[model samples]
Structure formats: structure tokens, C-alpha cells
Target: MEQKAAAKAKAPKRSQFSGMSKALVRRETISAYLFLLPSLFFFVGFVVVPMFICLIYSFFNMGLDSTSTTFAGLSNYVRMFQDPVFIRGFWNTVLIVVVSVPAVTAFSLWVSSAIYQMKPAVRSFFRCVFYLPVVTGSVAVTVVWKWMFNPYNGLLNQMFNTVGFDWLGNTKTAIWCIIMILFTTSIGQPIVLYVAALGNVDQSLVEAAQVDGATKLQVFWKIKWPQIMPTTLYILIITTINSFQCFALIQLLTSGGPSNSTSTIMYYIFYMVYRYNDFGYANAMGVVLAIIIAIFSAIQFKVTKTDN
Candidate 1:
């Protein structure tokens, strides 16, 4: 009888301990959510709400004057297809994305592979060198590039003995110059990411592969590549988006000039909003650009998932 009474008394204490743990977990969860609330509020208020507003505005004929708003219902979208400047801008945007993404991915991977095996201090030095451009303000970088590409007495022209040649003014060379600048600015983050990813790769697997007499390329393809697929996908998508939104360079350098040869969809969207006060059309273009980015990201995700 005494043993049974003792067992009953201990069972109540066990239940009380369990209940206390449950309450503690609930309290911690609430505290965590409370900490997240501020970020959640801003994300919803700025990003999510603005996105929906843009989508809604895209279907209307909105202007600077709010009283002029009217339902346009696909007219803005239809106009985009018919606009020649938009068409040119679309092609230019595509060219940037196509050229920049692969180049950045390949170059970053190569550079990372070379440097990741180096001593820690050496690796850090290279990482800082590459990442400097990324951390530098876009406007400052553009100014330096602008000075370099200046037609008269520019460093590039001085070096080439073509001091009077206007690089940004020539229709043939303008887009290419922009592409080159974009390439330089875009490679930094990818290199840093790739270095980290490569460093994190399974050393054991690499050693085993080497023991089996695998070539360096074989080990990379069979071991390292698969592990870094996620990082590569992220780099691809971000580079694509950045390339698509190649605006400040064009704005500061060419302003979509020299017969619109350097025009991109993003620049065109800004031009529409500021020059024509065509909010509806600009929002429509924004929507289309968003869709294109999403599609590209999806394709990258699918490909990377398959490879993984």
C-alpha cells in the first residue's frame, strides 16, 4: 500500500514537469515570433503590398493625376508588344542576361577553385580584392568607368592612342562597353560565394576519389560540382536579375542613347514613368520583367534540383 501511494505521488510530479516544459516551449515560440514581427511588418508593408499594388495598377490607365485613372484592361500589355523601343529594350535585356550569367558563373568558379586551396590569408586577400567592386557604390564605380571610357583624354583612349574616339557614343560599341562594365561589377559576389562553397565541399570524398586515381577534373565533376549546385543556382539567378536590371550604368553613362542601342527594359521602364508619366505602362513592364525573372529562376531551380 505504501509503494502504490509513493508511485502515485511521483506520477503527479512527472506530469507537473511535463506541463512546465510545454509552457516553456510555448513561451519561447511566442518570444521568437515577437522578435520576427518587426521584420515581417516591413516585408509585408513594403515588398508584398507594393507588388500587389503594381499588379493592380498595371491593368489601369494611370497617370500622374490620380483623377485620370481608368480601367485599361490589357491595353498596357498590348501596347508593350507594339512598342518598338520596348522590343529593342527586351532584346538588349536578354542579351545581357545570356552573356553575363554564364560568364559570371564560369569565371567565379574558376577563380574560386584556384584560390580556395591557397593559404587562408592569401584566399582572404583575393576575396577582398574581388568583393571590393561589389561593396563600392554603383554611382562611384560608374563615375570611374565613365572617366575611363571618356572620348577625349580618357585612360583607355590614351592607352590605345585613340584619344578622340567616343566609346559610349558609338552605337556599335556602347552595348558592349556596358556589358563589360556589368561583367566586372557582377563577378565579385559570385566569387566570394563560390570560394565558400568550394571550401565547404567534402574533403573525405575528394581524398577517396584521389586514392582511386581520379583526375582533378573527374573529382570536381563527380564530387565538388554536385555539392555546390545550390550556390551555382543562386549565382545564376542573381546574376540574371542584376543583368536584367542594368540601369544605373546605362543611366549614368549612355542614358539609352546612340540610337537606343544601349537601351534595356529596366531603363525603358524608368523612361516611361518619368518622361511620359505612364504609370500603367511602366507597371505593366515591371510585371513582365518580374515574370521573366521568375521564369528564369524557376528554370535554374529545376535544373539545379535535377543535377543535385
Candidate 2:
């Protein structure tokens, strides 16, 4: 009886403290949210409100010149699924993201690793050369690339013809040329990020590995690679997101032409809204793209967590 009474007394104290703790938690949450009020207001006004409008607008037939919105529900989404251009655009974006992400990421990492071994001045010179393309506008780059890929007069075709091969005029060759152009133009920022990451890698670890008789390749693969994994993930995520929204390059370089082979989702969206007067379906595409990009960025953050 005594023991049971003691247990009963302890339970009420624990319960009382638990209740107080939960109240305190609620208070803290309210305070935190209060602190977040101003930023949240701006976020809601800009991002959240626009997102909500897009979501609602995506389900309505809001044509140009029509002041009234008619309910479309899943009609726009269903039509998008059946749309061949939309399908092609979706697939092309995926293709570019998959190919370009790894190519740019790996090449940047390799180049940065090489540059990491060089003198500061030499490294700066190379970094500046690589990054010069990044500051130059994408439209200008595409225009220059268009000229460079010209069937007769372009430097690329000239080189190919010099090597006694037909180039750039062929559908296959032109597509590859476009890919190389996009790849080269996008390589700069990734290279810079990789350079920063490489700079942070510990010299002590590299020396320790060498003292343990680790070869250059092994040291790089095991030590340097792991150290820069976080930076690589960031680069990959940003590149993937940016690749999806590629408009200027496609619009300028090929305009999804040579038979719409290079049409990306963003280009498709732009045309659907701006050219075709289909705001409903465009909103659907935008929302879906935004959701995908958010999910990818979240995955990147989780994967790169140092605690992991």
C-alpha cells in the first residue's frame, strides 16, 4: 500500500511537469512564429500567394481577353498528359538534366582538383578564364554558339571538315554540338564552387595519407572526393534545377527546332502561355516543375547533412 501510494504521488508530479513542459513548448513555438512574422508575411505575399494563385489558376480556363474564369478541374492536366509537345519537352528536360548534371559536376571537380595543386596566381588565371563565360549573358553565348555551329562558316564545322568529316549539318551532329555548347557554357559556376571546396580540403589529411603510402589516385579518390561530396551535391542540385528552367539558351540556339528535338519544359511552358494563350496548362506545368525542383533541393540538403 505504501509503495503504491508513493508511485501514485510521483505520477502526478511527473504529469504536472509534463503539462508545464508542453505549455512551455507551445509558448516557445508561438514566440518563434512571432519572430518569423515579418519574413513570413513577405514570403506569403510573394511566393506563397503566387503559388496558391498558380495552383487555383491551373484548374481554370482563364483565357486572354476573358475576364471570367471557368472551371477546368483536371482538364488542363489531362490535356498536358496527352500533349505530344509537352511530352517531348518533359523528356528533353529530363535528358538534359541527367546528362548535363553529371558531366558538369565531374568535369568541374576534376579541373578544380588539378587547379588546387597549382600556384595561387596560376589557379586564379585559370579560374578567371573558366568563369569568364558565366558573366557573359546566356543569350549572347547562344548567339555566338549558333554562329560557331554554322554548317559552312562555323569554326566547329571548319575543324571537322579539316579532319575530313561532315559536321554540324547532320541532325545527330547538330544535337551533339548543342549539347557541347550548353555543357561548356554551364561549366564555369560549377568549376568555381568546386575550386572553393577543393581549397577547404585539409592538407594535413593529404600528407597523413601520403605518409601511409597512399598513391595520388587513391588519396584523391578516398580523401579528396569524400571531403568535397557536400559541395558536389549542392552543385548537382542547383544545376538540375537550373537545367529544368533553361529558356534563353533553347529559345536562342535552336528554338526547339531542327524538328523540336531540344524543346525543354520551360520553353514549352513559355510558348503555351505566351504564344498559345493557354495560361491554365502553363500554370500546371510551372507548379509541377516547381514541386520537382523543391523535392530535389530538399533531397540534396538531407543527403549532404554533415550529421549523416
Candidate 3:
């Protein structure tokens, strides 16, 4: 009877402390949300509001400067299918993605692998060199490239006088020129990421594989590849999106020129908005671009998951 009475006395004390802990947890949660409220307000005001506006405006025919609007229904979306320029732009965008993604991923991997084992000074130097193109603003890079690609007096043509190739003027070479520049800019971040990922790979596993007489290639493929898959997936998705949104280079370099041969979806969107003043059509194009990017990202995640 004494033991039972003592147990009941302790139970009440425990319950009292538990209730206090619950109240404290609630207070901390409320404080955290309060801290987040300002940033959330700005995010909603700038990003969310604009996205909703774009969605709503995409259903109506609107002009850049005019106050009037007409309900467009699906006409803007329907017209995109019939637009020859949009089709060509889409195909060009696809070509850019197809060519750039693998090239960027592979080249970055190779460079990162090479530099990852070097002395710290050497690795840092190479990293900075490869990343220079990215930090130098896109406008500046494109301008320098423009100067280099000049057919008459550009440095590239000066060296290849006999071949006499018009790097940016010829339709066959214009897109590739853009790709080459895009590549220089794209690999910088991937290299940094890859170096980080490679550095974090468990040394014990690599040492074990070596002790087992595994070749360097075998060790990398077996032990390292799976660990770095997440970083690889991230690189792939970002590279794809960057390739899709390749606008400044096209705008400053070719302007979708030589019969729209180099036009991309982004370039076409700009053309529709500024050149044609079709706000609704441009918004529809923007929406479509977002959807396409989402689809591509989904497919990449699915394929990577299956491979894993």
C-alpha cells in the first residue's frame, strides 16, 4: 500500500514536466515561424504573385503597351503548334541540350578527376581557370567571343586564314559556336561539385578495392559512381535547364539569324514579346518552357532512380 501511494505521487510529477515540455516545444515552433515570416512575405510578393499573374494573363490577348485585352481562350497555345519558328526553335533547343549535357558532364568529370588528386595549389589554380569564364559576366564573355568570331579580323579567323570559315555567320557552325561558349561557362560549378563529391568518397572502400587487386577504373565504377549519383543528377538537371534557357548568347551572337536556324524556344519567346508585342503568346511560351523543364527533370530523376 505504501509503494503504490509513492508511485502515484511520482506519476503526477512526470506528467507536470511533460506538459511543460509540450508548451516549450510549441513556443519554439511559433518563434521559428515568426522568424520565417518576413522572407516568406517577400517571396510570395515577388515570385508567387508574378507567376500567378503570368498564368492568368496567358489566357488573354494582351499587348505590351495597350490597355485593351481580348479573351484568347486556347488560341495562343494552339497557334504555338502551327508556328514554324517555334518548331525550329524547339528542335534547336533540343540539339543544344543533347549536345551540351553529355559534353559538359563528361568534360567536367574528366577535369575534376584529373585535378582532384593534384597538389592543393595546382588544383586551386586549375579550378579558378576553369571557373573564370563563369564569373566574368555573361555579357562580357559573349562580347569577347564576338570579337574572336569576327570573320575578317577576329583572332580565330586570323589563325585559320586558309580555311576561311565564318564561325558565327554560317548556319552549320553558328550553333556550335554558341555551344562551345556555353560549355566554358557550364563546367565551372560542376567541377566544384564533383571535386567535393570525389573528396567525400570513403577512402576505406577505395583502399579495400585496391587491396583486392581492382583496377583504378574498376574501383571508380564500382565504389565511387554510386556515391556521386546525386551530384551527377543535380549537374544534369541544371545543365539541361541552362541549355534550354540559352538566350543571351543567342541574342547577342546570332539573334536567331540566318533564317532562324539558331533560334531556341527562349529566343523565340523574346522575339514574340519584343518584336511582335504578343504578351499572351509570350506568357504561354513561358508556361510551356516551365512544363518542358519539369518533364525533363522528372525523366532524369526516374532514369537515375532506375539505374540506382
Candidate 4:
């Protein structure tokens, strides 16, 4: 009878504890959702709504005037292929992506591997040095680069003693100059991410591999590479997307000039919308560009997953 009474007393306490936990969880969940509300509101309003609007507009012949709009029904998309300027822009965009992505990834990984094991202060200093251009305004960076690439008074020409050589004017060198700038700005974020990823690698596995007579290369490939694959995948996708959206440099520096040699799909899209009032075509190009980015991201995802 005493044991039964003791059991009966404990059952209420257990039930009460469970009830308190449920209430606490419910309250915490409500707080979390409340915290998320602002971000969700902006994301839905700005990004999701705009995407849907652009997709809908792509199928119509749109312009600055609403009355001018009519059903285009894929004609704008069809016209993209037939347009020579767009073709050139497409290939140029492709070249930028092809060149920038691999170079940025390799260089960032190399720098991170070299610096991640340094003292905290030294590591942070190097991180700031690499990341300066990223935090600096794009306009300022472009202005400095523009002065450097100036034909007569620029540093490059003066240093080389090739006075009045238009680096930004020449068809062959213009795109490359843009590429170099893109490379500098692009590596900062990747390097930071890679440093964090590399620092988080399993030190025990790495030490064991080294103890087994594995060389640095062997240990990296066998142990560290798989661990940092996710970071690598992220870097590849972001770099690829940035390369595809190569617009600011082109606009501020070249404006797709020198016989349209430096023209990219992004610049072309801008030209179409503002210059020609071709909203439909611009939206179609945007849709296509989005699709291309998606495909490339998917490929990277698949390849990285397989490697891991």
C-alpha cells in the first residue's frame, strides 16, 4: 500500500514535467517564427514576387507603356539566338565563367591552405587584406582600376613605357583586364570560407595519416579534401554565378565597346531594356540566364557529391 501510494505521487510529477516541456517547446517555436517573419517578408516580397513577375513578363511583348504589351509567346526567346550581339555576348559570358571559376577556386584553396594554420592575429590580418576589395565599394575599385588602365597617364602604360596604349580600348586586352579585376574581387570571400573550412578539418585523422607516412598531398587528398568538399562546392557555384553576371566592370569600363568585344549577356540585357525599350527580350534573356546558372549549379552539385 505504501509503494502504490509512492508510485501515485510520482506519476503526477512526471505528467507535470512533460506538460511543462511541451509548453516550453511551443513558446520557443513561436519565438523562432516571430524572429524569422521580417526576413521571410522581404524575401517573398522582393525576390519571389519579382521572379514570378519576370517569368510572366517573358512570355509577353512588354515595353515601358502598358498598352504596348501583347502576347509574344516565345518569340523573344527565339529572337535571342538569331541576334548576333546576343550570340557574341553569350560566348563572352561563357568564357568569363570558364576562366574565372577554376582559377578562383584553385587560388583560394591554395591561399587558405597556406595561411589557415597561422597564429590567429596573422590569419585575421591576411583575411582582411584579401577581403578589402570586397568590402570596398565597386565604384571606387572601378575608378582606381580605370585610372590604372588609362591610356596616357595610367600606371601600367607609364611603367611599361608604352605611353598611350589603350588597354581598355584594345579588343584583345579589354576582356582580360576585366577578368583580372573580377579575379581579385572574387577570391576574397572564397579564401575566407576556405580558411574556415580547412581549419575545421579533422586534425586527428590528418595526424594519423601523417603518422602512417602519408605525404602532405596524400593526407590532403585522402582526408582533408572530402571534408572541405561542401565549401569547395559553394565557392564554385558563387564564383560561376558572379562570373556570369559580369556587368559592372563592363558598364563602367568598356560599356561593351571596342567592336563589342567585351560584351556579355548581362550588359546586352541592360542595353536591350534601357536603350531599345525591349522589356520582353530583356526578361527572356534573364530567364535564360537564370536557367543556365541553374544548370551549372546542378552540374557542380552532382560532381561534388560524386567526389565526396
**Local distance difference test scores for all models:** 0.92, 0.80, 0.91, 0.92
What local lDDT does model 3 show for residue 250?
Answer: 95
Per-residue alpha-carbon lDDT of candidate 3 for residues 265-308, written as tens digits (9 for 90 to 100): 99999998888899999999889999999999999989987786
Candidate 2 lDDT, tens digit per residue, 32-135? 99999999999999999998999999999876867867999889889878989888888878888778878988898888888967999999899888887777
- Give model 1 RMSD, 1 decimal: 9.0
**What's the lDDT for candidate 4?**
0.92
Model 4 C-alpha lDDT per residue in residues 1-308, reported as the tens digit of each score: 34776999999877754646777978988998999999999999999999998899999998899998999998999999999999999998999999999999999999999999999999999999999988896778988999999998899999999999999999999999999998888999999999999999999999999999999999999999988988999999999999999888899999998899999999999999989898889999999999999999999989887674
**Per model, how many backbone clashes are there?**
0, 0, 0, 0
Ordering by TM-score: 3, 1, 4, 2
- Residue pairs with clashing backbones, model 4: none
Rank order by lDDT, top first? 4, 1, 3, 2
lDDT of 1 by residue, 1-308 (tens): 34776999999777754646777978888998999999999999999999999999999999999998999999999999999999999998998899889988999999999999999999999999988877896789999999999988689999999999999999999999999888889999999999999999999999999999999999999999988987998899889889888899999999998888999999999999999999999999999999999999999888777664
Error of 1 at 110 (Å): 0.4
